[model samples]
Target: MPATPVADPFDALDPVARRATPRVRIAVGAAVVLFIAAVAIAALVSSAATGGGAQGTIVAGGGAPATDLGVAAASDGGASGSPRVATPPLLVHVLGAVTRPGLVELAAGARVVDAVAAAGGFTAEADPAGVNLARPVVDGEQLMVLAVGQAPPPATGGAGASSGATADGTVHLNTADVAALDTLPRIGPALAQRIIDWREANGPFTSIDQLLEVAGIGDTVFSGLADKVAP
Candidate 1:
């Protein structure tokens, strides 16, 4: 009617409503942008964890590569690949005259003699008497050898030689070197050497009676050694 009520463009839009519309649009755009960014970040993280690549790249802590534990030493001093030696089951028993007696296990084909040596060999007085040094040892076999110069130890197990009920025992004069002769009660190194020198100079004694010819041996001394001496 009045020139169609010439409307003002500014008046056509309400100032308060216009301002509110822009704010709403800005907030909705921001929310959509945040959602898209979040989706992109999540996709990237998932791909990294599962080892994604053109083909399939290995990633540490992901489904990646593995190492062989049985590797031999490499040029860098790390293992690459190899095998280990397998040990055999071996057992042996050592007894008699050894410093320690017991059962021991060793590598297969180990010798009995080796087992005895492992147990500490023979004691100072061990009787090499009946022992066959060259005999091959078997598992669980018992070795018994006597000590030097002593009577066979009684089966009863005392380490000392047993004294005879009468007159003790006789000493072997022929085998009695100075060291052996020293076992006599009062004899010492000097006397022992003297006796050994005498025996060496003369032939083997024919009888126990010939001992008197040695220096320092007289009737009374001979009587004392009568039961103790042997030819």
Candidate 2:
């Protein structure tokens, strides 16, 4: 019989082939691991860029971090959140016999004495006795300080001291005491006190019409007094 085909048992043990097969498998496994890692890294970077993470990140002006952007926004909000405070002053007109007579600004609840003091006090010729310094000053009211020995102007236009009497006779506004003032028509004790108070606060009245400026007196009361009272 023909010699049987020679069996080469060492073919399976070829050194180069054995070593190269294991090396190829190891290289393919390492390449797959590296590809997976690259994909994961790319996903992380995309999420951060789009601000999709729980602690969102922002690329601000000049590529500033998210924290810096938040801080800047907070600062701006704080600056505009506070409110401003304001307080208005009272304006008054001070006239006659003061060293510096004109408009003066005073705090609320200021008195006539405070206004006079603001106008450099009274001049030596000023008659302080006629002015009630303790009176509370009203806005837009003119304060006229009288000069000593000055005579008040005569009443005219039927508004001056009465030349005729009404049964009990007319009472003088400048000279009348509280009891005397109460005798005129519609003149009660309270109204009388107000008149006296007004006369004391302001200097002697130059005309009966000036009575209208008193706190309590109005057109109705003035008309009633017009026929009977004088400056």
C-alpha lDDT values of all predictions: 0.58, 0.69
Which one is best on TM-score?
2
TM-scores of all candidate predictions against the true structure: 0.28, 0.35
Tens-digit lDDT track for model 2 on 1-231?
A: 899988766468788876688788999999999999999999999998978766735564454466666676576664434754445666766766899998899887898899999998999998787566777766655566667865432223242223222334566677654434655667654676688788888978789898898777899988998877776
Alpha-carbon RMSD to native, per candidate? 18.5, 13.4
Task: Give candidate 1 regions above 4 Å deviation.
Answer: 1-168
In candidate 2, which residue ranges exceed 4 Å CA deviation? 1-87, 153-193, 196-231
Question: Worst ten-residue run, lDDT, model 1?
Answer: 157-166
Clashing pairs in model 2, backbone N/Cα/C closer than 3 A: 160-230, 161-230
RMSD of 1: 18.5
